[model samples]
Target: MFDRFIDYVAKVAPDKIAIRSFEGSITFAAMNRDINRLAHALLDVIDNSSEIVAVNYKQVHIHWMLLMALSRIGVASASVSSNSEIAEKEIAILQPDAIISDTLFDIDTAAKIHVLDLNWYDQAMKRFKPDPIYTLYEPDRIVRVSIAAGTSFMRHRIDYTASMIESSVIRMITQEKISWSLMSEIPRYPTLLPTLAFGSFHGFLCYLSIWSIGGTIIMADREQYFAAIAMLSPDLMVISPAQLQLIAENLPEDIPRQDHLRLIVVAGNFPNGLRHFVQQRLTKNLNVTYATSEAGVIASINIDQINHDDTAGWIMPWIDVQVVDDQDHPLTYGEIGNIRIKSPNIVQKFFQNVQDTHKQFKNGWFYPGDLGILNEEGLLRLIGRVDELYNFGGDKFYANKIDAVICSIEGIKDAALFSMPDNDGIQQPWLAIVRGGNFDIDQIARLLEKEFYNLPDVSVLWVNSIPRDEEGHVLRNHLEKLAMQYIETI
Candidate 1:
C-alpha cells in the first residue's frame, strides 16, 4: 500500500519540495531517502520482537520521519509531545522496552529498559551501509495504546491490532472514496502548514494523502506562515478556526493578495459572526471544515454547507452518528442528546484500563461526551458537553450558551462559564471573562441579566486568559482552580 503511494510521488513532481520549515526545505527524493534511513535506524533499535519503544519528540521533520519509519519497521511506538508529564507517566506505566529521546533526560525512574537518543541515531544512520529498499510495509501486530482524558478517576488504555489498522484504513478509503475523489478535486501542487503537537493530525494526514498522490507538504511555523501563504500561494491550507479568525482580524484591509489560494480548511467551534466576517472578507476562497486526530477524520463541513449560526457542519461520509439519551438509547433527529459515533477509525479501546475499555467500547460505538443535535437537513450542530449543563432554580443553563452570549459583547475577546461551589457547597454557575480592553462590568452584567433571567445569581470574574488544551478544549480543571481562588478572595 505504501509502495503504491511512494510510486505515485515518484511519478508526479519527483523533484518538488515536499517538506519545509524555518530550517530549510527537503525535496521529494530527500524525504524518501530520510524515511529509508530512519527505517533502518528503527530496525537497529528494536532487533527483537515484543520490543516497545516510546518516542519523545516535538513536531519536527525528524519526528515525522521517525513515525513513518517505526510503522515501516513494524515497531510499537507511542508518541508524547513536549511538557506532557502526564503522557510520560502513562508511557512509563506501559513499560516500553526502549525509550527514544530527542535530548538527554534523567528519567531514571522510568521502567524502560534502554534509552536511545535520536540525535546520536541520526548521526549513526549517515555512516550506515547500503540504503534499505523501499518495500511494502504494514503496521506492526503489537497493541496500540492511548490515555483517556475523561473525567474518570483512572486513565484508560487503547489497543488495536495491525489487522485492525489496515482494515480500518482500507474501509475509510473505500467508503469515503478519498483516494480517487481527492486526486481529481485537489490541486496539482498542494501544501500544508500543520500546527505542531498532537494537533498535527489534520496536517499530517493531509500531507500523507497528498504525498500518496504525489503532492508537496510545505512545513510552516508561526513566523513563516503568513509570508509563506503570500509567497507560495498554496493551493490548500489547513488551519483552526481560532487561527483563521486571528488572521482575518489582524490582516490589513487593502492587502488583496490571496486570490491564488484555492481552499482554506478550518476546524473547531467558531462564532457565527466571525465566520461571516471571514466569508465576506475572503470572497474568492473556498472554506472547508476538517477535524482529525491520530485516529482519523471525525467530521467535516464544506463551504457551501456552512451556516454562520451553526458551529459544526455535516458529518463526514462513513461516520455512523446518533444522538443518545442518558441511558444510551438513540434519540431522533433534532432531539438534543449525547453524540455517539461508530466508525472504523474510532479507537477500539483504552490501553490498559480494562474496565474503562469495556465500559466505553460497546457495540462498536464510542461516546465522545459531546452533546449535539442533527437537524432535519442532516446537519450536526454541537451545543455543549453533556456534563457542562448546570441547573439553576429548576432551569437548565449551558456553558456554551452563556459563553456565546458573553463573547458576542464588543469588548470581550473570550469567555468561559463553569459551575462553582457556593458557601453552602452547592454548585452555582459562575462566569469568567477574558477582555480585549477595559469595559464597564456593570453594563456587561446588565446585558447578561436581561438575557439570562433565571441565572440571576451569576458571579463574574476577570481572568487574564482562559487555558486550553492542545486541541483547544477548555481546561475546566484549571478554570475551576482559578474560580476557587477568586471566590476565596471575595
Candidate 2:
C-alpha cells in the first residue's frame, strides 16, 4: 500500500537525506534502491510462503531496513528484542517461519533461521539487483507486529496492517497538519531531525508520517541523543518523558531558544514544573501526546492550549474515546472511569493470546488499562492505570501522579508507586525511589500533603533503579519483585 508513496518521494527528491543512523547516513534515492535490492535478495533466504519473520539485530538501523524489505515481500515482520531471553519469548509467541539474527543461533527451534552477521546487507546487495515489481499486499493483511512491554514474562503481540498503519499516520499527521501553524510555531513538515524507533508503534508511525512528507530521521542511541540535538539543531523531537528528563539534565546554563522546534512528549502526565522546565530549556512549541499501541495518537495538545494543565489535550475527532464505568456503560462527562477507545486503527484483540484478548478487548472497544476522565469540552485527563489505583487508609493514590510529583522534585531521578498485600491480605502502597544526590527524603511527605490532603501513609523504598518499559511506563510487577527481594535481605 505504501510502496507507491516511497517511489514518489524517491523520484521527487532523490537526494533528500532519508535516515542518519549511528553507522552512516542514506539518502532517499539510495535508501529506496537498497530496500528494493534487499527485497529481491531475501527471496532466496526467506521461504516464499513465510507468514512472519522476526528480526533481532544489534543495530536498530538494520532492523528498520530488514522490516521494510520483509514488508515489500508481503510477509509480516516483528522487531525481536536484542536480549537473548526476551528474543526467545518473542520468537516463541510469533512462531515465525524464519528467524534472522546477527549472532549464532543456539536455541532449539523448528523454524528456518539465518545468522547474517554485520556484513549481511553488503552480502545481500551482491546477490541480487533485480528490477521486478511484486503484487501489492492486501490492505487487511498484517504487515507488522509489535511486542507490548510490561512486567509480563511473555509479551502480547499487537499486529498492524496497511489500512491500520495508514489510519495511524493520517490521524497523527495529516489531520494535525492543518492545525500546525495555527496552534504552534512549528512547520507543517516537522521532521528536520527526529529520533525515531521503528520497533514501537508510535515511533514507527512518527517515522512513517514524517517520511510521507520526505522528512529526515536521525536515529541515535539514547546516550548520543543530546549530542545529536545540539549538533543538528533539530526542527522536531519526538521523545518520551524520561528522555525529556535527560535532555533537561544535560542542557547547559544558557538555554538555546530553538523557536522552530515542535517537541512532542509521548506517554505524558507530568507535573507543571517539569512542563515549564521543558518550555524554558527546550522549546515553548511543545506538544504532549497521549497514545496507545492499539489505538493511534488519541489526544495531544500544545503547551499554550491550556493553563496549568497536564491534559493529553482535546480529543481527536477521528477517535471515539469514552470514560466508561466498570460494567462497560459509558459515563457522563467530567466523571472518572476506565478509558475505552474505538478507532479504525484499533485491533479488536491480541494476535494469539486469548486470555489478554478477553481482558483488554470487548465489544469492539479497547480498554487501554487506564483510568481517566473526559470533560464536556472534549479534554482528556488520564489519572493513571486502573491497576495502579491503590486504596490505602481510605485514600486513593494515583501511581502516575505519585511518580510525577516525586520525579518533579529536584534530585529525584526516577520514582514508581507499587504495592504489596500484607499478611492480612490488605493492600499497602510503597514508593520505590531512585534518588539522586542533594534531595531530602522528607520532602516527599511535604509534597504529598500539598497534592493530596487525605492521602495514605505510603512507605518509601529506596532502590538503585526502578524498572521501566521503552516508553517509560513503570513496571509494577518488577517493582513488586524488587520489594520482596529487599524484604528478604532485611
Residues 383-439, candidate 2: write the lDDT tens digits: 777877878887777878777778878898788898888879888878898878788
lDDT values for all models? 0.61, 0.76
Count of residue pairs whose backbone atoms collide, per candidate: 6, 0
Task: Tell me each candidate's RMSD, in Å, in order.
Answer: 3.9, 2.6
**lDDT (tens digit, per residue) of candidate 1 on 180-230:** 243335455556555434313334345455565455666665656666666
**Residue runs of model 2 more than 4 Å from their true location after superposition:** 1-4, 21-25, 108-110, 149-154, 183-189, 192-196, 253-255, 408-411, 443-456
Clashing pairs in 1: 157-350, 157-351, 157-352, 158-349, 158-350, 158-351
Residue 8 deviation, candidate 1, in Å? 6.1
Candidate 2, lDDT over the whole model = 0.76
**Per-candidate TM vs. native?**
0.84, 0.91
Candidate 1 lDDT (Cα, whole model)? 0.61
